[model samples]
Target chain A: MKQRLSTLMVAAVMTASFAAHAQQPAKKAPPPAKAAAPAKKEGITAEFEKFREVLEEDNPAELFEAKGEDIWKNKKGPGGATMAQCDLGLGAGVVKGAYVQMPRWFADVGQVMDAERRIVHCMVKYLGYKEEDIRKQPFSNDQRTPDHVSVITYVAAQSRNLKIAAPQKHAKEIEAYRIGKEIFAYRAGPYDFSCATCHGDDGKRIRTQDLPNLRKPAEAVKAYQGWPGYRMTGGFMLTQQWRMNDCFRQQRFPEPTYLSDSITALLAYMTVTANGQVYKGPGIKR
Target chain B: MADPMKIRAQMKGDTAEIRVLMSHAMETGQRKDNAGATVPAHFIQAITVDVGGKRVIQGQTSTSVSRNPVFGFKVKGAKVGDKVVIHWEDNKGDKRTDEAVIAA
Candidate 1:
């Protein structure tokens, strides 16, 4: 419980209205003096950055973290087992610093796994849940949220402040990384835009939201760290797995399968690109 | 299974600080899904806080509020070990109440 956290963590929804109010005024002003300005990205991007500063104080993700911590220890599923003993690649039941090492090798599945995929694996193997049932509702929607998402928020938060060091020792992990790199570059869909179109270049944005050039190390580090974040726009906690899927949606491509090998490969590519950077997340995002 | 709300209550001298995070769609009914179907509005209309079974703070909310909203308040004349209960009622009449104990 972060009850006394000195940092001013805002209640969700309250600040979004403020951000919306701040977004339009600058653009509506007489354009003569500001129109010729280079890039002209200052209006909404500046406002969002300021808004992010305020949200950064206390992320709503912490609420999920609290719920997740309880779920980790409580018995559930058909097997009546707690998720506490499931291995996160650092050995059984070890949570701290486990997330940063993931998208790494796991000998049991014999392939590299992302947090969602791994959690699903644990759910099946340890808790006796069906994979198809688990995959059916992986993302949170208007009606409800799968327990897995909060579990992930709990798992990912454990690595807060640790350096991202995704292992490439295994051939499978290396291959996953290579596949992820390629996925990051492969362009297609209605817009013919790859992740590169937005994330490949520096200082790119869709509207007011700033896009991080995940190709570069520092930006990758910063972007990669905060995922499984609370999104102000969507009003939900989104996992990195959800991040990959949403990106594909925005690209006008068909929906990407949750925790598919391709998505894991993309994560391998990103976390690896962000290697050696300090992770400070379970972050709040716009 | 019902959706859970997170509650934290910390006693600061004579006053107890309480914060709550509620998980709800808060769907505005105006938005559409990817399939273009209208998502009906579902949101918390009111929130009440009680300590030691006594009513204290009551507030109202609307659809304009964001999903999974967070709210915090300070209660006077509170002490450590006092039980803090938060009850919320949505427009659909769906209700959730969660409680926490104040820390000394």
Candidate 2:
């Protein structure tokens, strides 16, 4: 798989190099200084768009979504209940159109929650599973119990195509969004790294992937919707909570309790900031 | 498990460039050694990058990740000549850290 991807990468880069060379004027007439700036800007955008197109064909995230669906409908947990009955904030057992409205306030829960937390509630309340039981199992060993990996993939897939509409109607929901926005900008760690460190700007990439600016709508919506994806690096489906926890680990801050308020807040910010943008995740990622 | 992980970091423009070489088998638990016994899964559970003691990026990883996963990303506002440090911990509780100076 890796070899095929490398070959494709080389082919793409070579193609771009050839295309770029071809586009140059044969006479090499120097354009006006004013024209040069806009040309450069347009070229950069075009290049990035092309790069995104190349990656779209080979996203590895599909495999995880497939597996996640299997896990979701499969009966598990102490009660042997499938997740089909779990409510994702659209109503009990309602899977479709639930994700976009999430990070919203649910009076039943009395606190703001994101997709992951809501999944946990279904596992605990409806399925009669203990929270500790799920957390204690190692990622590798745990093959059951509404496993965070599979359920997240399943839930996120359900949200695919729905526009982000994280509601802020309730006071607590609004508070969560406020806290989430603050968390996104807060910088505290041994290295003083904040989410802004990598995501504050446009037109930057880590290695091959572009880092989306979280402060912006179009980019944030597109990027935020792509998680709960099957990460090529992790080799399994992951939810946003897992994504956020991993981000904290990389940030060198103590692990944010998985599915904690901090993560919920972050999701709130992302969902709200991403309002009206469609979700297309359970996506493949490198 | 006791081996020291080698870490190197550099400041490249507004981002802190980091590379970590950890001593781990990163066992996928899907592999069997020649002895036919399944190798238990072992991999880095977390990695963190700190610039001048501020948290930047944190990641949760697993055996599916590449061995000695060499991850790189930039932290905005990290200037040249700043100290960039990287630390990693595996499920086994093994820890390693390394630091490098940012270049102008």
Candidate 3:
């Protein structure tokens, strides 16, 4: 009886999906000559791409970058020290081309740190802002954006058009990459889903959104770059760290703590895999 | 105090192309917040563009505009090195003005 019921359920699901497809507007139906092509999906993707192209010309992310530049140069926090002197891997006060080489081993912290982590560290060290206070509301919401996100946006924009060259020189950097690779494939949580489940292969998508294959260099660059994007839906500026946390939530896994090492590891792996691609600065997202 | 706008003016042939990106909440007043309170309406109401100290474009906007809205204008008789100033006033009485020079 149970076997028969399971079969019946499967049949119902198939019928429901067929009905959903049938309900699509007649205007969206492909002509008979293009029956063999995935015309419907391609059309939607193309439309989205066109929309993105139009919005990309005047991205709102630039506004955040400007705000960040102001914050970086101005004195604030308890220490009242400007972040202008903050060292972002290359040396103190160097802003250009520092973003593309992030998730590197920072000897001062003795850990592999990504761009967001390094920015927060500078905020703490130079600006005297408490780490916990900053972590309390790290992600942007509809109403407000955290200062660090804007700072990262500014930093990332400085590296615009630079090639991604996430260093794997140090032992710790290599270890972070390895751990990131593992985390990408490790499956857990109620959904039994991993990042690789959705992104490990090409031509994968969730609903209408195409998922880039993280394992392939070409596709990995697509996934890695254009982050720290300005999300049009919410008009909020978000960083890759927020993206990674949201991914975990979608998989029904426990969200990692803000500025955690594991999140840095994941970023290291993705950035390293996407090495050599020119980052197009901060991007606009649908 | 309101944040400043980003203005870019460039010479496109004889006409000067002016693009402005303004930052605002642009709340429609129809939407509710996470705590179920109605968010107040706040949006840019009037916009004016001055080219070489002459008013070239004056317009009004409403809640329909998106947050951090971008506006573009084209003005004749403006040359490179001409000053383009954009000023906007919101419904809440907040205002911001920013200027840029037309570039070749």
Candidate 4:
């Protein structure tokens, strides 16, 4: 199965690159500027990496983590119950190392759920929040961030340095992974683009940002790690689900419903593929 | 109320390294919103750090700082277990104070 996927990906990359080259105007740029472009790009990328390293030492995500800890222990919501008893597949109140093992099957809900999805589910089931209300503004904007994103950040921080171990023991979990793989390769929409178009091969980049090859385990971890990240541009917390949603938007595809199964399936595929890699906790992103 | 800041204080050879992460919009009031209305300038105007009951840092900041700003300071003659308190007041008069104990 893996061999066939890689072979297909090579073909896709060939056509994609050909299309890119064919679209360029038959005009030559000044030779000097063209010669200096790659070197300048490398310099900027290295400097940006250094800046990120410094910022990571004092990540603003820590503030959200503190806030999330408060919400988990405090009594609020319509149910007036605390989320301290909520189970994250590791047992109720067991937060340590739970984030890395998520996108797992939950028998109670009879479905597979990612970290954000499960947290929202617990908020509804235990804390008595209306799913509709929570879904209304699931993402963060310039003004404010919804509570659940903070909660995910807090939870992810607890699993720092733990290996990714998203389980596939359950039949449904296996099913979700299969569906996720199909979804990744499935191409449709105005551009006829799939996730593979940008991320199926090594050395693919969108401008200065390098796209990780999710099909390979080493590169797959790059996709899984550093999520539920604190984006410095807008200074807002964002989750993997939001990243996936934004990708669809960039592709000009219809937006997936918040906490939808399709997103969970995709997460399962990515997380399981990234098994055994260490999660560096909530990250600071440019 | 604003979110609580995350403060870390660690002792490095008698100097306490204090790093604070404060949560604020730090709006410069220069940028227009989606509706084209100017965003009101709301940034931390004052910051003070106290270690072991002694004032160590009293600084002023402005709209130039980014949102969710981070600040680091090193205080000499600090010991382990010394209390490190960070206080900040924004242009809107909103204030927050958070403290941490110096770790070896």
Question: Which has the greatest lDDT?
Answer: 3
lDDT of 4 by residue, A1-286 (tens): 3322111111111111111233433443455864676645554465557667767888888888888888787847664667877899999978998899998988898889999999999878777878988888999989778888888898999999899899989999999999999888889899998888987888898877778999887888877766888888777899899999988887778989998889998888888888998888688788
Give the per-residue lDDT of model 2 (tens digit) for B33-87: 6678887887778877666656666677776555433343545556666676777
lDDT of 1: 0.79
In model 1, which runs have C-alpha deviations exceeding 4 angstroms?
Answer: A1-41, A187-192, A252-255, B1-4, B7-19, B27-42, B49-56, B73-86, B91-104
Clashing pairs in 3: none
Q: Model 1, A140-207: lDDT tens per residue?
A: 76555577788888999899899999999999999999999998999999899898999998988776
Best-to-worst ranking by TM-score: 3, 4, 1, 2
Provide backbone clash counts, one per model: 0, 29, 0, 0
Candidate 2 local lDDT, A3-58, one digit each (tens)? 22111111111111112334434434255743767535454454555544443443
Query: Distance (Å) between predicted and true CA of A230, model 3?
Result: 0.3
Candidate 4's displacement at residue A228, Å, is: 0.1
Tens digit of per-residue lDDT, candidate 3, span A1-286: 3322111111111111111233324344456634566544576776567667756777889889999999888857675667877888989889899999999988887878999999999988888878888888999998889888899999999999899999999999999999999999999999899999999998999877899999987888787766899888868899999999999999999999998889999999999999988888698877
* Model 4 global lDDT (CA atoms, 0 to 1): 0.81
> TM-score winner among the candidates?
3
DockQ metric for all predictions? 0.19, 0.02, 0.10, 0.18
Using DockQ as the measure, which candidate wins? 1
**Which candidate model has the greater TM-score, 2 or 3?**
3
Ten residues in sequence with the least summed lDDT for candidate 4 chain A: A7-16
On residues B4-24, what C-alpha lDDT tens digit does candidate 3 reach at each position? 888878877776777777888
Winner on TM-score between 2 and 4 is 4
| lDDT score of residue A275 within candidate 2 | 92
